[model samples]
Target: MISRSSQTAAIAFAVLILLLSASIGNAYEDVGVSISIKGTRSYKLKKEAQLLAKKQAIISYLKRVNPSAVGKSCAKQLVNDRAALIKRITTQEISQVGDYMEGSYLVRIDDEKLNYMLEELGCGAQNGATDVTILIMEEPPTKANISMILNPEDSTGVRKLRGLGPFAVFYTSYQRSIRDTIISKANKEGLKLTRLDTFDEFQKMRMSNDDPLVGVYFDDESEDFVINKRLLKVVRTRFAAQNTIVLYYRIESLYFDQVTRELNAAIAISLYDLNSGETKSVGSQDFMVIVPKGQSSVAIRDGLAEVASNAASLLMNQAKKQIRRMASIAQVHAQKKGTLPVTVTVHLKSKRTMYNVKKNLKPSMIRHSEIKGDSLILKLTKGIQADDFVYGELLGVLEGMGIKIPENNINLNGQEVIIQQ
Candidate 1:
């Protein structure tokens, strides 16, 4: 028979071991893994990195919880088959915890959900060890705000002017300096700048484009006293139906003020939305140099630079207001229905037609889309009964890309829209 003192000591030791095991299991419940990958700063790249980080974190958690099942061999296999594994896993709940550091990201995965996924993939623990719960905490995904700046090319062409009219044109001499300043300011304000020479380039760039809450087009060329009605009409027809909010700026006049005996410069500013197809004047301000009567040309140039800076500041403030309004609309829509599905069917002409179409649509707006030979079935996210906005935007994009869709060939049935070339 065992001695009573010995029995008590054995029980105490067993209890302590159990307690330690519980503590260890609890420690492995939540896991955070840091991932560093070199890639361009883009929505697609960030999303891919996020998925990869999540996969790494989940694998790490699995290894900690069940070393035997998720050992070196399993880890190697998971890494090799990550592309397939990523499709099976859902990351709607998983959150990226911090800002990307030197292209590195911290990803947190819920232990329970991860284990479930692993088991579903036939990579569960050998002995059904299930005591891990450590998960990285992260803020929920929120709506994104974006802004863009467009720079006009010096050379002119039918395609070029077609792409850049109504927006201010840049003077060849100071275009680079002004562009650099705008970029710097936009960077400080967390805005995205799309540097393009022409609207044709803009169309090509739009395929994988970010949705801009505000678009500021810089045109610094001196405007003619008489507006060209024919040119303006053509521009209106081409770019009038865009859904983006755009601010256009141009130098109206620059001359020596005879009465004030000073150099005077005026810039015309306008704000318009392609959605509404109207260009409303934002403001026109004159900058004057009232110092010495005989100022050097350099002094006049300096004065112009100052005026340009002031115009940029005013434009940015107006852009912010537009962004706020857009945000409010989005918030209201989100409250009503977080997302509504709209199906789009497009007739295909060539093999690359669908490819081009996919490139132009915003990725965030697309919930799911599939191309079936000559036809594309696109499921988009938007507000309920907002088909007009969707169809109008699509029409504008299609028109910009030189794709023709006859009015009679277009059809809308409830949430589904069909367009034939």
Candidate 2:
């Protein structure tokens, strides 16, 4: 019995020793293995790993070391030297995971080790166990998952702003700039930013349903600010209309020809709405032109060239009627007290000795013609000389009209004349 008891005690002691050894080995113990990156792109590993570390809440230690002359020579000995080191290192790391150790772990990582390892494996370890805390984080969320919405109250002044004629472009560009500025400010103000792939989706979101959190998105500092569709639509419609007007009416060149009668040479005529998409017609009459022929090319080009000036006077007389009809149809009011211009003013003169004198005078010399009343009017043109001949004709016309022609009353070469009484 004593021999058997001694044998049992020895076995028990051996078992305890084994357990104690195992526990001691495990206490304050860690296993770490070095990674040898391969290839020239190894420099990229540190950056990628750093990013991965931050994302995964892991700490990475990078040590700087100059290339060893001997190691460098050995590595340069063959094309696959770097590859061999990478294989060795990887294999060691993998096989050593379950290794039993009694001291703190260490992973000697340098730029060179990274290069050698990477040359063997094009990509770094994707998912695996490392002796150290090596964490590779998952990618961040994409912009497509987020939503945007425009607000309605924000859309009020947009249309009117877009109506400022040529200034509309500046406004549009300014709006984009302002939005970007707001986003940048938001970023500086500590707001998160995200980018959406398409702006069309942004334009479609409703007011209350979309997210209102503003963010920086895409490559630019655009307000990934969410807004309601109604608001966006208001701004979009006005801007679109303004752009349409600009594009449709943007004429690269314009030319005009005038049709005129001798009596109406001095009148100014032009096409008012030339090259506009709304007025597709090529005739000046389409644009309501009523100037004398050849007065301005704008009239014909603007589709208003066809309106006759002679007949325009008649139209002017009935202006109130036309405007009233237009106003009623257009649902807009016409301001009262608008007066139409008189196109023609007629004058009558008595045919007598005075009329002959005035009529016979050269165009260079001013002359007056007698009217039914004892009055005279001067007829004038270019190149008229102020002289006695012009005055004599005027004096005769005044006397013939039964007005006393004072010597002072007849001014030579006068553009206008008055009969003396």
lDDT of 1 by residue, 179-277 (tens): 444444433333333343334423432211331111222222532223333333333333221123344555555444334544444545554544344
Best by TM-score: 1
Give the number of the best model, judged by lDDT.
1
Cα lDDT tens digits for candidate 2, 6-60: 5665455345434432332111111243333332333365444333322211112
Q: Model 1: runs farther than 4 Å from truth? A: 1-170, 174-187, 198-243, 258-261, 276-281, 291-295, 330-338, 342-421
Question: What C-alpha lDDT, on a 0 to 100 scale, does residue 317 get in candidate 2?
Answer: 20
Model 2 residue 59 lDDT score: 18
lDDT: worst 10-residue window of model 2: 129-138
* Cα error of candidate 2 at position 318, Å: 32
